[model samples]
Target: MRNKNSRNNREVMKRILGCIRPYWFLVLLSLLLAVITVVLTLYIPILTGQAVDLIVGKGDVNFTGLLAVIRNIAVAIAGTAVAQWFMNHINNKITYHIVQDLRTRTFHHLQVLPLSYIDAHPAGDLISRVITDIEQFSDGLLMGFTQLFTGVITIVGTILFMLSINLWITLVVVCLSPLSFFIAGFISKKTFTMFKKQSETRGELTGLTDEMLGNLKVVQAFGHQEKAQEEFEEINSRLAEYSLKATFFSSITNPATRFMYAAIYAGVTIAGCFTVIGGGLTIGQLTSFLSYTNQYTKPFNEITGVITELQNSLASAARVFQLLDEPALLKDVPGAPALENVQGKVSLNQVYFSYLPEVRLIEDFNLDVCPGQRIAIVGPTGCGKTTVINLLMRFYDVTGGSISVDGCDIREVTRESLRTNYGMVLQETWLKSGTIRENIAYGSPDASEEEIIQAAREAHAHSFIMRMPDGYDTVIGEDGGSLSQGQKQLLCIARVMLNLPPMLILDEATSSIDTMTEIRIQKAFAKMMKGRTSFIVAHRLSTIRESDVILVMKDGHIIEQGTHESLLEKGGFYAELYNSQFAPAG
Candidate 1:
C-alpha cells in the first residue's frame, strides 16, 4: 500500500512553477546573499591556513598585518552569518505568499464548484486536501525551496574552494557525493509511499470526525457513543501507525547521510595527513581542507531532507491540481441572461433524466403550470418528487428536454437569476450558527430590521422568538441546535418569506414538524402562498386538498392530474393514494 512513483514529467512541474514566479526577485536576492555567505565562509578557512603559514614562517606573526587580517576575517564571517539570516527571512516571506495564493485559489474554485461535486465527494477527504494537504505542500515548498538553492550553492562553492586549494583532497570528498545521492534517492523513494499513506489516513480520520459531528444526535440516541469512539480510535490508531512508518523511513536518511558524510570526512582527513607528512601540501592547507571537507556534507544532508519533502509536496500538488482540473459538467450556458422578475409559469417539455447515463430515471415527463397557481405533486417514494425540485433548481442537467420559466429556457438564463426568483424550503431545515434574526433574514440579507420581524411574524416564528432571552437576537447554535426542529423550519420559512420570491417550493417542508407546529406553519404557509405560485410535495395527501391542481406521480410519470375533488371523483392513482395514506378527517 504505497503510492506509485509519479513519472509526472517536466510539463506538470512547469505548470506549478508559476508559484515561483512572484518570488523570483526574492529568490535572486537570497541567492546573491547566499553567494556572499559562501564566499566569506570559504575565505575563513583560507585565512586560517594563511595565519598558520604566517606563524610557521618569519616567527614574529607580522603583528600589525596579522591583527588586521584577524579582524577582517572575523567581520567577514559575522557578515556571512547575518546574510544567511536575511536570506532565511526573505525565503519565509516568499513561501508564505505562495501558500496564500494556492489556498486562496482553492477556496475560490470551491465556490464555483457545482453542488454535485460536493455530494459526490466525502466531506473528510475534501476538507483534508484544503487543510492538511495544503499544509504539507507548504512545508515541502519551504524545505524543498530553501535546501535546493542553498544546498547546491554551498556545496558547489565549498568544492570549488577545496579543489583550488588541493585537487587530491577535493577529489576524495567529491567521490563520496554520489553515495549520498544514491542513498537519498533510494530513501526518498521508499519514504514517499509512507507519506502518501499518512495523507490518505488523515483524510479518512477527518471524514469520520465530520460524519460523527453531523450525526451526533443519531449516534447518541442509538447509544453508539462508545462504538463511534472505538471506530474513531481504530482509524486514529491506523493513522498513528502509518505516521510512525513514514517517520521511520524518513529517519533513515539522517543516519544514512551522516554515515556518508563521515566516510568523506575520514577519507579527506587521511589524505590530509599524507600531504602533511610528505610535504606535498602544507599543514595549514591540510587543516583548511579538513574544515572544507566537513562543510561539504552538511548541504548534502540538507539536500536529502529537502528531496524527501519535495517528493511528498509534489504528490500533494498533484492532488490539488486534480481537483482544480475537474470540469464543471453542469454550468450556465454561454450568453445566458439573468432574469429580473420571473412570472411563476413553469413548463417541462419531453424531459428525460438520470444520475446514471444508461439507467434513465424519468422519461418523457411533461408538465405546465400557469402563473400564481398553487400546485401539489404527490407521488410514491422514488417516483421523482425530489427530482422535480432538483431539475427545477438545475442541480443536474436533463439528458433530453428543456425546462423553461416564463418562456425563457432555464438553460438560456443565468443560474443566479433563476434561483434568485425562487424561495425553496426543504424537508430538512438547516440553519447556520447565528442569531434568530440573522437566521430568519438569511434569504434577504439586506432586508430592513422591520422587514425581518414582519417576515418572522408571517411565518409564526416571531411569537416564540420574542420569548427567547435575547428575543430576535437570540443565538441559534450550530445547525439550529438551540431551537426545536419545528422552530428551525419556521425560521427557514421566515427566511424564505423575507425574500418574497414570486415562486415558492415547499418539498415536504412540513413532513418532520409535529402536528401542532405543522398546523400553525400551514396557516402561515397559506398566507405566504397567497397571490404567489407554490409547488408543494406532501406525503400526506389531505394536506394538499385545496391545491389548485394536483399531479400524482408513479414510476417517474404523471399518472394522474386534476383538482383534488375531481381526482377523487375519477378514482385514479391520486384518489387511491389519498385514500390509502389519508382518509381526510374521518
Candidate 2:
C-alpha cells in the first residue's frame, strides 16, 4: 500500500507540473525574482558584519565607514522587498490560472462522461470534488509557488555565504541540517494518508447533506429528521477524526523541525566561537556566520511547512484526477450522418440491458412503432418502465441487440442529432434560475417571444405566470424557487411544447399537476401527439387510455399489449393493473 501510494503521488505531481507547463514564462519570471530577492537578502548580512567590524571599540569606531555600510544595507533591504513583491504577484497569477484551467477541464469532461458514471455517483460528491477539492489544491499550490522557490534559493545562498566566511563552521551547519529533513519527512509521510481520508469523508458528508437538503420536505414528511441527523453526525464524526489526525501530524512538523534546527544553531554558535577565539575568524565574521546559520535554518522550517501543504494538495489532486480519468462516452461514429428529417418510426430488436451486469433489469425487449403512433407503457414501480425511456434516449446503450429509427441504427448517428429529435419531460421538473420566459425558451433558445407565450398558453401555465409580479419575465431560482410543484411541471411542459420535437417521451410528466390542469394539458398533448411518435410512461391508468398501443411490462418483459379497451377485455396483467388503479373503492 505504501509503495502504491508513493507511485500515485508521483503521478499526481507530474500531472500538476504538466498543468504549469503552459505558464512557464510566468513561472520563470517568478523564479528569477526569487533569486534576486534571496541574493539581496543575503547581501544585507554581509553589510551588517562589515559595520560591526568598523565598530572596533566604543571610541575607536569609524563612523563614516559604518554609516556607508548601513546605507548599503538599507539599499539591499529595499531591493529585496521590491523583488519579493513582483515574485508574489507572478506566483498569484500562475496559481490561479492553473486552478482555472483545471476547473474548466474537469467540468467539460463531466459533460462527456457516460450517464452510467453519473447515475452511479452522487451529485454532492461530484460537486465537492469540483469545487471544494480544487479550492484546497489551489491553496496548497499557491503556498508552494510562494515559498518553495524562495526557500530553496535562500538555503543555497546562505550556505555559499557561510562557506566563504569559514569552511569548518559551514560543515557543522550543513551536517546537522539533515536531522530536520529526516524528522519532517517522517511526519509528512503519515499526513498524506490521513489527509486523503479526511478529503473522502468530507465528500461523503457533503453528499449526505445535499441529499437531505434537496429533499428536506420528504424528510420532514416522513419524520426522518432524527435518522438523517444520525447519519450526518456519523459521517461528520469521521470527518472530524480524520481532520484532527491529519492536522496534528502536519502541525507537529514545524515545531519538530524547529527543535532540530535549534540544536544545529547551537552547534554552529559553539563552533564559531572557538574559531573566533583562535583568531581563525574575526568577531565580525563570527557574527556573520551566526546570521547565515539562522538564515539557512529558516528555509528548512518553511520548506517543511510547504511539504505538509503539498501533501494535502496532492491528496485533493488525486481525487480530481480520478474524476478526470473516468472513461468518457464512446465517441460518436466518425463521419456519421446527422439524423435529419426523422420519420416517427422506431424499432427495438431483442434489446438487453442492466444497471449491474450480475443483475439483469431489462433483457431481450422488443418493440416496433409506425410513424404517428402514441405508445403508452405501464407497469408497477421498478418494472423497467423508465428504463425503456433511457434506452430509447440512448442515455444507456443496450448491451445487446439494437435500436433504430427509420431503419438507421441509433449508434450510427450523431448523438446530438438523435437526441435533438426527441423531447422529454420527466416526473421531476427542473427549472434553471432564470425568468419564466427563459425557462420556457430553454429547449428552443432562439424561440421568438410570441412562440414562448403560445407554448405556455398551450400548457395552461400562462394564467398563473401572468399573476406573478413579472409575469413572463418573472425571475425564479433553481428548480423553480417558491413555485408550486404543479406550476414547475407546467413550466417544464411548456418548454417541450416550445420545441415540439419529432418524437416525445413523457415519463409521468403530469404526476404533479392537478386533475383539472392535467385534463387541459392532455388536450394539448393530444394535439402535439397527432403527428409525432410519442411514448408515455405513467402510473395513472386513465391518462394513457387514448394511446394507440398500451404495453404492460412485468420484470422487463412485455406481458400484454393493445389499446386500453382491448387490454381491459383480456383480463391479464394490464386489466389487473388498470382495475387496481380505477377499481371501485371497497
Candidate 3:
C-alpha cells in the first residue's frame, strides 16, 4: 500500500511539473533570484564574523575594518531583500497562471464528458472538485514555490560555506541533519493518507452543503430538515475527524525536525569550542561556522513544514487529476458530415441501452416517424420516458443497434450539428444570470429585439415580462431571481420559440404554467408544429391528445400506440393512464 501511494504521489508530482513547464522562463528566473538571495544572505554571516575578528582586543579593535564589514553586511542584506521580493512575485505569477490553466482545461473537459457520467455523479461533488480542490492545490503549489526552492538552496549554500571553514564541524552538522530528515520523512508518510482522506471528506461536506442549500425549500416542504441536518452533521463530523488527524500528523513534523536540529546545533557549538581552544580554528572562524550551522538547520525546519503542506496539496491534486482523467466523449467521426437541411425523419431500430450494465432500462426499442408527424410518448415514472428523448438527442449512444436522423446515423454527424437542428424545452427550466432578452436569445444570439419580443409574446410571457422594472432588459439571477416557476418556464419556452429548429422535443415544456397560459402556449405550439417533426413527452394526457401517434410505454417497452381517441377505445395502459388523470374524485 505504501509503495502504491508513493507511486501515485510521484505521478501527481510529475503532472504538476508538466503544468509548470509552460512557464519555465518565470520559474527559471525565480530560481536564479533564489540563488542570488541565498548567496547574498550567506555573505552577511561572513561579514559579521569578519567584524568579530576586527574587534580583536576591545580598545585595540580595527574600527575602520569593522565599519567596512558593517557596510558590506548592509549591502548584502539589501540585495537579499530585493532578490527575495522578486522571487516571491514570480512564484505568485506562476502559481496563479497554472491554476488558471488547470481550471480552464478541467471545465472544458467537463463539457465533453458523457451525460451518463454526469447522471451517475453528484453535481456538488463535481463542482467541489473543479473549484474548491483546485484552490487548495494552488495554495500548496505557491508554498512549494516560495519556500521549498529557497530552503533547499539555503541548505546547500550553508553547507558549502561551512566546509570552507572547518571540515570536521561541517561533517558533524551533515551527519545530524539526516536525523531531522528521517523524522520528517516518517511523519510525512503518515500524513499523506490522512490528508487524502481529509480532502475527500471535505469534498463530501461541500457536496452535502450544496445539495441541502440548493433544495432547502423542498426539504422544508417535505419535513426532511432534521434528516438532512443529520446527514450533513455526519459528514461534517467525519471531515473534522480526518482533518484533526491529518493536521496532528503534519504538525508533528515541524517540531520534531526542530528538536533534532537543536541537538545538532548544540553538538556543533560544543565541537567548535574545543576546536577554538586547540587553535584548530580562529574565534572568528568558529563564530562564522556557528552562523552557518544555524543557517543549515533553519531550512530543515521550513522544508519539513513545506513537506507537510505538500502532502496535503498532492492529495487535493489527485482528486483534480481524477476528474481530468475521466474518459471524455469520443470526438466526432472523422470527415463526418454536418447535419444540414434536416427534414426530421427519425428512426430507431433494435436500440438497446441501460444506465447500469446489470439492470436493463431500455431494450430492443424501435420507432419510426415521418418528416412532419407529431409523436407523443407517455409512460409511468421510471419507465424510460426521458431515456428515449436522451437517445433521440444522442446524449447517450445505444449499446446495440442504431438511431438515425433523415437516414444519416446520428453517430456519423457532429453532435453540435445534430443538436443545433433541434429545439428542446425540458420540464426543468434553466436560466443564466442575465437579462431577459439575453435568456430569450440564448439559442439564437443573433436574434433581433423584435424577434425576441415576438417569441415571448407567442409563449404568453410578454405581459409579465413587460411589467418588470426593466421590461425586456431586466436582469435575473442564476435560477431566475424573484420569478415564479411558471415565469421561468415561460422564458425557457420563449428561448426555444426564438429559434424554432427543424425538429422539436418538448418534455413537459408547459408543465409549470397556469392552465390559461398553457392553453395559449398550446395554440402557439400548434402553429409552430404545423409542418415540423415534434416529439412531446408529458404526464398530462390531455395536453398530448392531438398527437398523431401516442406511444404508451411500460418498463422500457411500448405497450400501446395510436391516436388518443383510438387508445381510449382499446382501454389498455394508455386509456387507463389517461382516465386516471381525468377520473372523477372518489
Candidate 4:
C-alpha cells in the first residue's frame, strides 16, 4: 500500500507541475532572479572577510581598501534585495494563477459530471477538495519551490566558495552535511503517513461541519442538537489528535537538523584554527570559511522544512487530482447528433437500471406516452418513481434496453440538446443568491421583465413577491433562505414556466404549498400542459386524478397502468393508494 501511495503521489506531482506549463516563462524568470539573489547574498560573506583582511592590525587599518570593500558590499546587498523582491512577486503571481485555473477547471468538470457521481458523494467533501484542499496545495507549491531552489543553490555555492580556500576543510564540511540529510530523511519518512492522515481527517471534519450547518433547521426540528454536537466533537477530537501527531514529528526535523549542523559548525571552527596555525589558511580565509559553513548547513535545515510542508501539500494534491481524474459523464457519445424540435413523445422500452451492481432499482420498466399526454406515476416511497425521472433525464443511463424520445434513442443525442427540451420542478427547490426576477428567469437568462412577471403570476408567486420591498427585484438569500418553503417552490415553478420546454417533470413539486395555492398552481400547470408532454410523480392522489394515464409501480416493476376511473374500478394498487389518501381516519 505504501509503495502504491508513493507511485500515486509521484503521478500527482507530475500533474501539479503541468499546471505551471503555461506560465513557464514567468517561472523561469523567477528562478533566474532567485539564483542571482543567492549569488549576490553569498558575495556578502566574502566581502566581510575582505574588509577584515584590509584592516591590517588592531589600530593599523588600511582605511582606503576597507572603504572600497565596504562600498562594493553595500551595492551587492542592495541589488540582492531588489532581485529577491522581484523573485517573490513573480512567484506569487504564478502560484495564484495556477490555482485559479485549477479551481475553474474543477468547477467546469463538476458541471459536466454525471449526477450519479454528485449524488453518491458528500457535498461538503467535494467543497473541501475544491476550495480548501486546492488552496493548501498552492501554498505548499509556492513555499516548496522557494525553499528548494534557493537552498540547493546556496548549499552548492557555499561549498564551492569554501573549496577555493581550503580543500581539507571543504571536504570535512561536505562529509558532515549529509548527517542532517540522513536524519531528516529518517524523520520525514515517519511524518509522511501522519501528515497524510491529518489532511484526510481535516477534510472529513470540513465535510461534517458543512453537513451540520447546512441542515441546522432539520437538526433543531427533531431536537438533535446533542447528538449532532457529539458527532462533531468526536470527529474534531480525532482531527486534533492526528494534527498533533503530525506536527510533533515535523517540528522535530528542524531542530534535529540544526543540532547536526551545530556539531558540524564546532568541528569546522576547530579545524579552521589548526589550519590557520599551520600557515595553510589565513585569518581572513578562516573567518570566511566558517561563515560559508553556516550558510551551507542552513540550507539543509530549510530543505527539511520544505520537505515537511510538501508532504502535507502532496496529500491535498492527491485529493484534487482524484476529483479531476473522475470519468466525465461518458462524453456525450462521440459526435452524437443534436436533438432538435422534440415533440415530447417518450418511450421506455424494457428499461433496466441499478444504482448498485447487486441491487436493481429499476428493471424491465416499460412506458409509452404520446405527445401532449399527461402521465402520472404513483408509488410508495423508494418504489422507483424518482428513478424513472432519473432515467428519462439521462442522469443515469439504463443498464439494459433503451429509452427514446420521438423514436430517437436518447443516447444518440447530445445531452445538452436532449436535456434542453425538458423543464423540471423538483420537491427540493433550489434558488441561487439573486434577485427574485433572476431566480425566476434562471432557465431563460434573457427573459424580459414582462415575461418574468407573467410566469410568476401564472405560478401564483407574483403577489407575494411584489409584497417584498424590492418586489421582483428583491435579492433572495442563498438557497432562498429568507423566503418561506412554499415561496421558494413557487419561484422554481416560475423558472420552469418561463422556459416553456416541450416536456415537463413535476416530482411532488407542490408538496410544500398550501391546498388553495396548489390548486391555483395545478390550474396553471393544466393550462401550460396544453401542448407539452408532462410527467407527474405525486404522493397526493388528488393532484393527478385527471392525468390521461396513471402508472402504478412496485419493486421496480410497472404493476398496472390506466386512467384514474379505470384504475379505481379495477380496485388494484393504484385504487388502494388513491382511496387511502382520502380515506376516513379510524
Candidate 5:
C-alpha cells in the first residue's frame, strides 16, 4: 500500500509538471535570477569578514577602507533585492497561466463528458475540483518554486565558502544537518495522513452545501431548515476535528526542527573557539564560518515549512486527477456520417438498459414511429419516459440493441448532427442569462428579428415578452429566474419553435401554465405538429386525446397501446389511469 501511494504521488507530480511544460522559459528565467540573487547576497558575509580582519590586524579601525567596503556591500544588497523581486513577478505569471490552462482543460472535458457522468457527480464537488483545488495547487507551486530555487543555491554556495575557511567545523555542521531533516520527515508523515482526510471532508462539506442551497426552495417548503442545519453542524464538526489535527502537527514541525538546528549551532561555536584559541583558526574565519552554518541550515527549515503546504496541495491534485481520469466519455465513431435532410422516422429495437448493473430500469423496449406521426407516451414517474428521451438524444448510449433515425444507427452519426435534427422542450425549463430575443434565437443564431417574433407568437409568449422592461430585448436572469415558471417554459418553447426541426419532443412542456394559456399553447403546438414527427409525454389524458396513438408504460414496459377512445373502452391500465385523473370527488 505504501509503494502504491508513492507511485500515485509521482504520477500526480508528473501531470502537474506537464502543465508547466509550456511555461518552461519563464520558470528557467526565475531560476536564473535566483542564482544571481543568491550569489550576490553571499558576498555580504565575505566582505564583512574581510573588514573585520583589516581593522583587527592593524589594531586600529581603517575608517576609509571600512567605508568603501560598506558602500559596495550595500549596493550589492540592493541589486540582489531587485533581482529577487523580478523572480517573484515571473513566478506569479507562470503560476496563473498554469492555473488557467488547468481550468480550461477541466471545463472542456466537462462539456464532452456524457450526461451519465454529470448525473453521477455532484455539481459542487466538481466546482471545488476546478476552482478550489486548482488554486491550492497554484499556491503550493508558487512557494515551492520561490524558496526551493534560492534555498538550493544558498546551501551549495555556503558550504563551498565554509570549506575554504575551515573544513573541521564544516564537517561538524554536515553531520548535524540530517537531524533537522529526520525531524521534519517525522512530522510530515503524521501530518499528511490528517491533511488528506481534512481535504476529503472539506469537499464533502462543499457538495452538501451546494446541494442544499441549490434546492433551498424545496427545503424551505418542507420545513427542513432544522434538519439541514443539524446535518451541516455534524459535518462541520468533523471538518474541524481533522483540520485541528493537521494544523497542530504542521505547526510543531518548525519549532521542533529549529531546536535541533540551535543545538548544532552551539556545538559548532564551541568547537570553533577551541580551534581559535589553539592559533589554528583566525577570528575572521570563525565569524565567516558561523555565518555559513546559519546559511546552510536555513533551507532545511524553509523546506520543512513548505513540505506541510505541499501535503495539502498533493491531496488536492489527486482529487483533480481523479476527476480528469474518469472513463473517457462517449464520442462520435471515427468517420461517422453526418445526419442530414432528416425525415423523422425513429425506431428503438430490443433496447435494454439500467442505471446500475444489478437493477434494470429498461428491458426489451421496442418502438417504431412512421414519418410525421404524433405519438403520446403516458407513464408514471419512474417508468422510463425520460430515459427513453435520453437514449433517443444520445445523451446516453444504450447498453443493448440500437436506436436509429431513418435506418441510420444513431451511434454511427455525429452526435452534433443527430441532435440538430430534433428540437426538445422539457418540463424543467432552462434559459441562459441573456435577453429575451437571444433566448428565443438560441439554436438559430442567425434568425432575423421578424422570425424571432413569429416564433414567440407561435409559442404564445410574445405578449409577456413585450410587457418586459425592454420588450423583446429584455435581458433574462440566469435560468430565467427573474421570470415566472410559466414564462420560462414559454421561452423554452419559443426556442424550439425557432429551430423548427423535422422532429419535436414535448415532455410535460406546459404543466406549469394555467388552463387558458395551455389551451392556446396546445393550439399552437397542433399547428406546429402538422407535418413533423412528434413525441408527447404527458400525465394529463386531456392533452393526448388528439394523439394518433398513445403508449401506456409501467415497469419499463409498454403495458398498453391505442387511441384514447380505444384505451378507455378496453378498461385496462391506461383506462384506469385516464379515469383516475378525471374521477369525481366523493
Candidate 6:
C-alpha cells in the first residue's frame, strides 16, 4: 500500500508538471535566476572563509579589506534576494494563467455535459472541484514544486562545492542527508492523508449547506433550527478535528526539518574543529564549508517534501479533470439540424420513460396534437404527470419510442434549437436575485421595455410589481422571497410569456396560488393558449376542465384520454376525480 501510494504520488506530480509544460521557457528562466542566486549566495560564505584564514594566519589585518569583504557579502545577499523574488513573481504569474486556463476549460466542458452527470453530483460538490480543488494547485502545486526544484538544485550544487573542498567530509555530510529526506518524506505522506480527509469532508459540508438553503422554507416550517444547528455543529466538529490534524501534520514538517538541520550542523561543526586542530583544513575553508552545508540541508528538506505536496495537488487536479472528462450523454447527432420555425405541433409516439430502472414512471405513452391545441395531463400523485413533461422537454430521453416537434425527431435537432420554441412554468418558480423586470426578462433577454411590460401585464403581475418600492427595478431577495408565492408565480408566467414560445408547459404553475389568483391566472393562460399548443399539469382539475383534451395516467401508463366532458360521461378515473371535487363543492 505504501509503495502504491508513493507511485500514485509520482504520477500526480507528473500530471501537475504538465500544467507548467507550456511555460517551460519561463520555468527555465526562473530556475536560471534561482541557480544564479544560490551560486552568488554560496560565494559570500566562501568569502567569509578567506576572511577567517586572514585572521587565523596572523596576517596584517587590513580593516579596509575586511570591511570590503563584509560589504561584498551584503551586496551578494541582496542580489540573491532580488533574484529569488523575481523567480517567485514570474512563477506565480505563470501559475495564475495556467489555473485560469484550466478553470475556463473545465467550466466550458461542464456546460456540454449531460444533465445526468449534474443530477448525480451535488452542485456544491461540483463547484468545489472547479473552485476549491483548483485552488489547491495554486496553494500546493505551483509554489511547492518550484521550491522543491530550487531546493534540489541548490543542495546538489552545495554538495559538489563541499566535495571540492574535502571529499571524505563531503561523503559523510551527504550520508546524513538521506536520513533527513526520509524523515521529511514520511511526515509529509502522513500530512497528505489528513489533507485528503479534510478536503472531502469540507466538500460534504458545503454540499449540505447548499442543500439546506435550497429547502429553507421546509426547514423553517418544520422548525428544524435546533436540529439543523446540532447537525451542522457535529459536522463542523468533525471538520475541525480533521483540519487540526492536517495542520499538525504539516506543522511537524518545519520543526522536524529544523531538527535535522541542527543535527547536521552540530556534526559538521565538530568534524570541522578536528580537521582544523589537525591542520588538515584552514579556519576559512571550514567556515565556508559549514555555510555551504547549511544551504544544502535547508533545501534538502524542501526537495524531500515534493512527493507529499504533489500527491495532494494531483488529487485536486484529477477531480477537476474528472468533471471535465465526463462525456455528454445528451448530444445531438453530428449533422443534427435546427428545430426550425415550429408550428407547435407535438407528438409522443410509444413513449416509455423512467427516472430509475426499477421505478418505471411512463410506459408506452402516446399523444398527438394539431397546432394550437390545448392539452392537460391530470392524474393522481406520482401518476407520471411531471415525467410526461420531462419527456416532452427531452430532459431525459425516452427509453423507448420518440417525441417529435413538427414531425422531426427531437433527437435529430440541436437541443438549443429544439427547446427554443418551447417554454415552461414550473411548480417551483426560480427567480434570480434581480429586479422584477430582470426576472421576467430572463425569458427573452433581448426583449424591449415595451415587450417586458406587455408580458407582465398579460400575466397580471404588473400591478403588484408597480406596488413594490422600486417597481420593476426592485431587487429580489434570494429566490424571490420579497414577493408572495402568487406574485412569484405570476412573474414566472410573465417570463414564459415574454419568450412567447409557440408551445407552452405549465407544470402545476398555479398549484401554489389561491383560488382567486388561480382564476386570474387561468384567464391569462386561456389567452396565452388561444393560438398555441399548451400542456397543463394540475391537481386542480377545474384548471383544465375546458381543455380540448385531457389524459389520465396511473402507474406510468395512460388509462384514459378524451375531451373533458366525454371523460366525465365515461365515468372512468377522470370522472371519479372530477366528481370527488364537485361532490364536496355542493
Top lDDT: which candidate number? Answer: 2
| CA lDDT, every model vs. true structure | 0.84, 0.93, 0.92, 0.89, 0.88, 0.83
Task: List, residue by residue over 1-586, the lDDT tens digit for candidate 1.
Answer: 2333555524436656887887788888988987887889888988888777777776567767678779989898799889889988988898889889988888888878877798888888888888888888889888866677777887898989898888877887787689888988888877777777788888899999999999898999999999999999998999899888888888889789999899888888887898889988888888788888888888888888887777677767766777777775456788779987777899999999887677668889999999989999998899998898889988777789999999998899898888888889998899999888788877777889999989888888888889999998888788897688888888888899888889999998887678887788889888888888899999987679889999888888888899999999998887778778766676
- RMSD to the true structure for each prediction, in A, is 2.6, 1.0, 1.0, 1.2, 1.7, 2.5
Q: What is the Cα-based lDDT of residue 388 in candidate 5?
A: 88
Candidate 2 weakest lDDT stretch, 10 residues: 51-60
Clashing pairs in 1: none
Q: List the candidate 4 regions with Cα displacement exceeding 4 Å.
A: none
Assess the local accuracy of residue 451 in candidate 1 as a C-alpha lDDT between 0 and 100.
95
Off by over 4 Å in 1: 1-4, 9-12, 54-63, 223-234, 329-331, 583-586
Question: Mind giving the per-residue lDDT tens digits that candidate 6 earns over 53-73?
Answer: 766656568677788888888
Candidate 3 local lDDT, residue 332: 94
Q: How far is candidate 6 from the true structure (C-alpha RMSD, Å)?
A: 2.5
Clashing pairs in 6: none
TM-scores for candidates 1 onward, in order:
0.93, 0.99, 0.99, 0.98, 0.96, 0.93
Q: lDDT tens string, model 2, 164-198?
A: 99888788888888888899999999999999999
Over the stretch 394-511, how does candidate 5's per-residue lDDT look in tens digits?
Answer: 8888999999999999999999998898889999988999899988999999999999999999999999988888998888788896799999999999999887889989999889
lDDT by residue for model 3 (1-586), tens: 9999999999999999999999999999999999999999999888888888889676879988888899999899999999999999999999999999999999999999999898888888899889988998999999999999999999999999999999988998898788888889999999999989998888888888888888889999999999998998899899898899999999888888888888888999999999999999888888899999988989888888889999999999999999999999989999999999999899999999998899998888999999989999999999999999998999999999999999999999999999999999999999999999999998889998899999999988999999999999999998898899999999999998899898999999989988988999899999889889999999998899899999999999988999989999999988888888899998
**TM-score quality measure for candidate 4:** 0.98
Give the local distance difference test score of model 3.
0.92
**Model 3 misses residue 44 by how many Å?**
0.7
